[model samples]
Target: MSRSIDINKRTELKRLLLTLDVKAIPLWGKMTPRQMVEHLVDQVQWTNGKKTATCDRPAEEAERARQLMIYTDRDIPRNIFLEDLPDEYLYPDMETAINQLMTELDDFDEYFKKPGRIAIHGGFGPMNYDEWLIWHGKHFGHHLMQFALM
Candidate 1:
């Protein structure tokens, strides 16, 4: 299980992300700011709704899911697929990218305040909010790292 990110920490994270100067990273492959935003937007929309895409194997696959959940906590690999958005991907520019990120984080923050014991994660079965939080913290943090922002 993961811990949910508190609002304070989330706020600080947003502050940090908003200040990033993406152009500074010279070798983040060919992924443009539009591509990055689009990829991330797709992911957030997927989780918040039903526009599903590739996901880690579900908990029904038990052992593999466990292994991947463990890995999700660690460093995101180089050549991250999110940074390799396809030519067909649609994305807003840098300014809108940052705004959309902020919007989603705020929405998640509000969602966290509602009480529950378990959340049906994409692959990890029903997890308490705290569990989901730890996972989200790592997940979002990894991307922030990818953007050279956190």
Candidate 2:
């Protein structure tokens, strides 16, 4: 599969963000538009190795989860709340959130280019750049669908 952190994919993600408004409501989830964007920012930070996660399973099980979530074309399970994020990246409006996400996207690109970066996912264990990219894409797509953008 193509890595989801590529320039074209990031552009596509940005394009999707343009469809959202501050007052946009979710179709199937509870996060506000700003909250969803903040959630996405957290995910990107994790993928960029700015944050670390403890393994939630043994290596075998973690690998299985990674393959199922990152390699398959299945939708992420709905209503999953994996972490409690701080309000720092939670902008008060959609426009600001979009800008922060775009900036983080650029940071992710730079981080992914270096060697020996380690991204440790809570459930999926450690991930290389490609695996992290896939997870990030799946994650963003999931939240986008939550707000009826996908």
Candidate 3:
């Protein structure tokens, strides 16, 4: 079974991220290292309710994807893209982007402290805190691999 890096391991995540620089190129995707950091920041913000996006998939499809992706120990497929997400980088530099991603991760933990809190995911529809954590772990691991950081 494929296992994802634990998103709760902030120190380890930061250490890995610090190894990345703006010049690093992806092995399989279009996003630069800086853009990837910003993308993660955006995703973390969305999951924590700091940003919002509507579910684009049908309810049944979303549920099926949510079940397969969250429950199974499968790694996210390479080069997957969400059409609604921006391709351009958002932060001024890689450092700012990484800092923002870390901040959002911190917020993610705090936001889910409330009981029964849930957030909408574009592809997976509504997700609870645990589901989001698993999703982030997979998502981060995928990107980290894309850049050969893992």
Best by lDDT: 3
The residue pairs found clashing in candidate 2 are none
lDDT of each: 0.55, 0.74, 0.86
* Candidates 1 and 2 compared by TM-score, better number: 2
Estimated TM-score for each candidate? 0.61, 0.84, 0.91
| Regions of model 2 farther than 4 Å from truth | 1-8, 84-89
lDDT, candidate 1, 105-130, per-residue tens: 56555565766623355556555555
**Lowest-scoring 10 consecutive residues by lDDT in candidate 2?**
1-10
Candidates sorted by TM-score, best first: 3, 2, 1
Worst 10 residues of 3 by lDDT: 81-90
Give the Å shift of residue 30 in candidate 2: 0.7
